[model samples]
Target: MAWYHSYFKGLPQVAWKLHQDEEYTDFEVDFLRDVLELKKGNQVLDILSGYGRHALPLAEAGCKMTCIDISAEYCDELSNAKTKRKLPVEVLCGDVLETDFGQGKFDAAYCLGNSLSFFPRADMLRFFTKIAGSVKPGGHVALHTENLAESILPNFQARNWMPVGDDIYYLAENEYRPEEGCIEAQQTFISGSEKVTHTVYQYIYTLAEISAMLESVGLKVVGTFGNLEADPFVLGDEQLYLVAVRK
Candidate 1:
């Protein structure tokens, strides 16, 4: 099984819940709204929509939302929330690569929270092709990631430890393979007396490579930003937020 198939459950989920910040989500949603030129009745797709952080807010604002995620646990939570709120949101739980997003179905789509780095070259190309095909001509797609080659390589750390929430302590030991253009990481989460470890991989791509891939899929690169505030993307900016329009 892929590392992500099991990595996002249990303790990692708990850590993610604690890491949630409403302010940050609002900022990102605002950025998405502006970049995508979203309207109240527009249909939007949230790829790998973990727990509906951005999906929920966008749905509340009256956009129709279709969220696809791999984690059943997160999907259940999002479904229950949607039920309670009576939002126009549809939740689909499965591997994104295998799921059909449908052609020309959405006005806009987004893959956020560094989820774009999960796939290697070939799979990444397939994923972008799916996104390109899913949106209508002139529709927009937004991608967010912190694993860009320029950003990560300049600040590469072999090992790092940080606190997650109040009780969980997290550590990551990373090994960068230049030949494969990926980072293999062993991540450990410790809370109270319980501890768990998982291995994850994030494929790195240069900005030029990413632009080329999107172009190859018939998506033209439109805007690139370093943050939600619309700052220009600079080398070592730590985040890449790219917007593209389908041709």
Candidate 2:
């Protein structure tokens, strides 16, 4: 595995430390249900459901969820949470690229938290095709991610820091490669006197590029939002919340 591939594999505490905002989680889950039209007992697929942040809440909302993640620790956390809460949640530990849930298997599906960009650009189409094959005809799919346009902005900040907790901070530096259509980032976690840094790469796709890719895989673009509350998508928005339906 590459140095960045398993960067988040086993550290649930660290993951939570970086993304512990309950309001953000609730907003995402709300958008998933509202936009996807998911209801109680509906079958949903959550790709890269790290630590069940979204899956557990979706299960709580009465959805039968199948969550897949490469992180064994995250899957274990999900399994334990499901068992403890008696929620209809199935945790699958495997690579998203290799997993096959069969065609027309789900009513709704989602890949949130910028997970879609983790794969190389060469595999982008295959990834979307796989997702299209997993959902039933007319089923909805939602993807929340950082807008690629942001990377190309004239005033894009290459480095930034986010305070995580008392005496702890998360630092990030982004380097965009226009020729390769990807971003290589160096991320550092500083907690009191301890600090760790990791480098990772992610492909950046424009809204048009992503829409075309999804369409090529039989997923018709239905809606685009700038936020979780369903605001219309516009240029300069840092995030993109795209909703599509299987044809």
Candidate 3:
């Protein structure tokens, strides 16, 4: 089974809500405009591009983008965005690890929204190698993911619930595995007359771990920050947006 499809399909409503909220932050847009240093006619790849959050804006910016994602729904969302403006965007539905996109095809690349946190440590290293292989020489890559080192991991199982519009959001429990350096989040959303549950597992990588993984993949960490604004990485920053150059 395709992991991304299964994970995202179960998360449509929340993901849609995250993008739809009026005061929502369009970090993708900020990255394209500010962090990515995108030049005119840059060929870019949005690895795990979800729901056109990053794809549409880059296309509108006159970028020739190859949007890669495993979710058909998200891929269609990109198509719909292009149709809305009669723009051209190549949206491909496939796995990032298996897709034969050809090495050094893109001028630059980006992976945002904590998309890189889905894999285990070794797979994450492999992911970096794959991304580096896809990037052309002198090109760069911007990766966005949670700063797991700053994440507040509770010591015991705790139940928490909140409301998101019409849905009652609930985290049934969460546990931190210190030895494994991972956090397990089990959650459920109750909306109207239905309830759906899903578990989100992620590794809590320290700054050192991330740096090492990049180096192991032959990518040099050019810069590391807490956000798209290039804010200095502080002791408690929750976002890690790393910029790297292919070696």
Tell me the alpha-carbon RMSD of every candidate. Answer: 0.8, 1.9, 2.5
User: TM-score: which is higher, 1 or 2?
Assistant: 1
Clashing pairs in 3: none
Residue lDDT tens for model 2, 23-125: 8888788888888999999999998888888899999989999999887777887899999999999888888778877678999999987776777766788
**Which of candidates 1 and 3 is the stronger one according to lDDT?**
1
Cα-based lDDT for every prediction: 0.94, 0.82, 0.73
Q: Compare candidates 2 and 3 on lDDT and give the better one.
A: 2
lDDT of 1 by residue, 1-247 (tens): 6678887899998898788788888999999999999999999999999999999999999999999999999999999999999999999999998998788999999999888889999999999999999999999999999999989999899999989888999999999999999999999999999999999999999999999999999999999999888898999899999999999
Best by TM-score: 1
Error of 2 at 182 (Å): 1.3
| Error at 178, model 1, angstroms | 0.5
lDDT of 3: 0.73
Q: For candidate 2, give the lDDT of residue 226.
A: 85
Task: Report the C-alpha lDDT of model 3 over 136-200, residue by residue, as the tens digit.
Answer: 88788888776367644422335666666555554467777788777677767766676777776
Best by lDDT: 1
